[model samples]
Target chain A: MPENKDYLNYIDRTAPKSPLLKNALLAFLIGGLICVIGQLIGDFYQKICGLETDSMRTAVSVTMVFLGALLTGLDLYPKIAKHAGAGTIVPITGFANAITSPAMEFKREGLVLGMSAKMFVVAGPVLVYGISSSVVVGIIYFLYKVLIGG
Target chain B: MATRLGNQTIALDKSVSIINTATVVGTKESEGPLSPFFDVKMKDAEWGEETWEKTESKMQKEAAKLAIQKSGKTADDIDCAFAGDLLNQCISSGFSARELGIPYYGLYGACSTMIESLSLGALAIDGGGMDTALAVASSHFCTAERQYRNPLEYGGQRPPTAQWTVTGAAAAVLENGGAGPYVTHVTSGKVVDFGVIDQNNMGGAMAPAAIDTLCAHFSDTGRSPESYDLILTGDLGRIGREIVINMMNSSGYNMNDNYGDSGCMIYDIEKQDVHAGGSGCGCIAVTACGYIFRQLKDGKLNNVLILGTGALLSPTSSLQGESVPGIAHAITLSNKPGGEG
Candidate 1:
């Protein structure tokens, strides 16, 4: 039998490498574009609605999420994501797509069992880690204030 | 009597011919270079089915029916069928068999299923177990994507090594006797894992198995690269094809001129945006039943070796961080029943 370690090394050396520079550039531009759009929406909420800072942030997020879900439903997000890579994924819109895609795909299986149950298949991991990390950080901050500040 | 050559190769005493074949492909495949060769091409992926899975089954059924019809026989004339697909439980082949009402042997060799069915069907014919048998395999892009990767509408970027599953089906009618393009030798491969864990780089994972099988076929048959007019591998994509060529060259066999891959042949990589190239059971199935069969019948090619490569990994296995194991079964198709052309 051929040596597994040697075989793997050969494969790694021979296989074509992904264009890291091109992907990073695309991700930056697309991600910047989405954030710019979000900024514009935030500006509108601040100037026109005269909302508070916290309320404006919420409004901007809601608007962005709506747009993401709408784009996903129209089947245009995936096309963009194909080229955008992490640009589309690192944003809130990516989370929306993650949730909406499975929901759309599993609608055939029924609303509760298919759509609702499978909706978090992709986004679930992100949510679990994100929330758990936040909680840990919160506990650390609480302990720091209680000990150091006291 | 069928004699075992060396370790894995089998030489059938009686002749088993692929009397006829039919290929049915979806829109993307129909737009490929081999578009004109396929028997039936659907205008859309749906093919009037409610779901992608049903569409795959329909394609399989249509291909099977057309193959039987082209062979000048009915479903009743065929004794049994060896069929499979890249779906959970092999549902596509099972549904197609249900419609055809042929005694079914459903297989799951991942992408290697087409040639797996072909090899077994040829054996059945050569063993005098049945006068006629059907070998069919199918895979739909949407079905495979949802099952193996992500949802159809999921917004995710595929890596460069990722392969697009071909949306199509192909069926061959194998009989105990026929004019030409006979199944002469069968080399069933062993599962070889080089500990490749990346699911996207399926070609890398399957290349070792393809290399192992090819080397065995050459040693057992006492033939070299020049023995066959063409050596076609099933769905190894462009990368896998290159690796096989390089490894085989290092092993003292030069396959530079006569080698081809079904994955690279099914789609125009530049135009189709298929990343590495086409994959899945339908990749080799359509290429063999449509393009290779045509070339052999027209006397343009005499001998060809088809190696069906498959990465045997499930979503569960990938999630559990298990390495992907691969297998490749080689079948030699020649214009002459025995001896060199």
Candidate 2:
């Protein structure tokens, strides 16, 4: 019998490659569209809502997150993501979907153990890394400031 | 007495016939190429069930009932049932068996459960342990997605190598004596892992096992690829099917002309968005019970060899970075009884 590694190599040689260029192009366009929508929302908050810059940014994020969760609830985001690939994943809206999708799926398991616990099933690692990296960066900044007197 | 052939194959002495079979599939499969061959096609995936798990159980139950009904046998007449599904605890088969109320053997052979059950059921009758038995296997796309890959509404991209889990169930009634379409031989497979870890490319992981079993069946029975009218692999999608053909050719067995795959035949790959093709336990079960069984009954096919391929990977195993081990069980169905030719 052939070694497992050799078999894996054979499979790798024979398996069809994913259409990387097409996927990348689709992701770029769709991700760009999402960013443009976020920018438009920010502008709306700035011009019409009469909000401060910081408050406007928060409002824009909130609106975008709401839209993402709504689309996920309506069962439309997954269909879009099927074609959009990382285009849906790179945006903050994707993060919202990550949380909402599990919540909706696990709802049958009940609210506490099912919905609440599994809500972060997909996004849990994101939050963990995101917060951990921020803390590490904060420590580095603190050390640099103290030692260098900046 | 069923005599053991070379190493892996067992040639049954008595006739063990697949009296009847029934298949139930979801709307997506109903729209597929083999739609006309199925016994029941659900209007929707949900089928008025509150959960996908429940829907799968319901499909299995309906299929089992239909199979028994078609065979002119009642539930009480069946001595036992062998059933399985691609759920966390094999809950779909368990629930269906509970409703069926026959002496049950709940199996977990991943996608190979269909043939695994059939092989066991035929063996029991051949061994005189049972007179009549039912073999059932089911899988629902929604249930499998949530259990194995992701939630139904999750927005994630699947690779082109990924297969669509078939939403269907199939049941076959096997009796100790019948006129034709007999289970003449069985070659049980060993778990063979090629160290493939990609969960998306299940076909790649499963192809080696199918090849192993097919080779064993041929050597044990002293048969060649041309001995059978069709040599079908269960749920080895296009890529896996290609791999099998290449590997078999290198092994000095030419199966290019007679070889077919249930996964590729289940759906129209060009039109259907199923990238690799249909998969899961239901892929083979429905194809065999619906299309192949009909063809065999209509005299279009005389002798057929079916190898049900399964990638034995669980969510926990995949998460732990374990390689996917594969297995395939081969069953030979012939119009003539064993030892005739």
Return the interface RMSD of the candidates, in order shown, one decimal each.
2.2, 2.3
Q: Model 1, DockQ value? A: 0.59
Give a tens-digit lDDT track for model 2, residues B1-341.
89999999999988999999999999889999999999999998899998888999999999999999999999999999999998988999999888888999999999999999999999999999899999999999999998997778889888888999999999999999887699999999999988898988999999999999999998999899999999999998999999999999999999899999999999998798999999999999999999989988998998999999999999999999888899999999988889333
**Global Cα RMSD, each model:** 1.5, 1.3
Which structure among the candidates has the greatest TM-score? Answer: 2
List the candidate 1 regions with Cα displacement exceeding 4 Å.
Answer: A1-3, A143-150, B339-341
Docking class for candidate 1 = medium
Worst 10 residues of 2 chain B by lDDT: B332-341
Question: DockQ, in order, for the candidates?
Answer: 0.59, 0.66
Summarize candidate 1's per-residue lDDT along B120-145 as a digit string, tens digits: 99999888889899999999999999
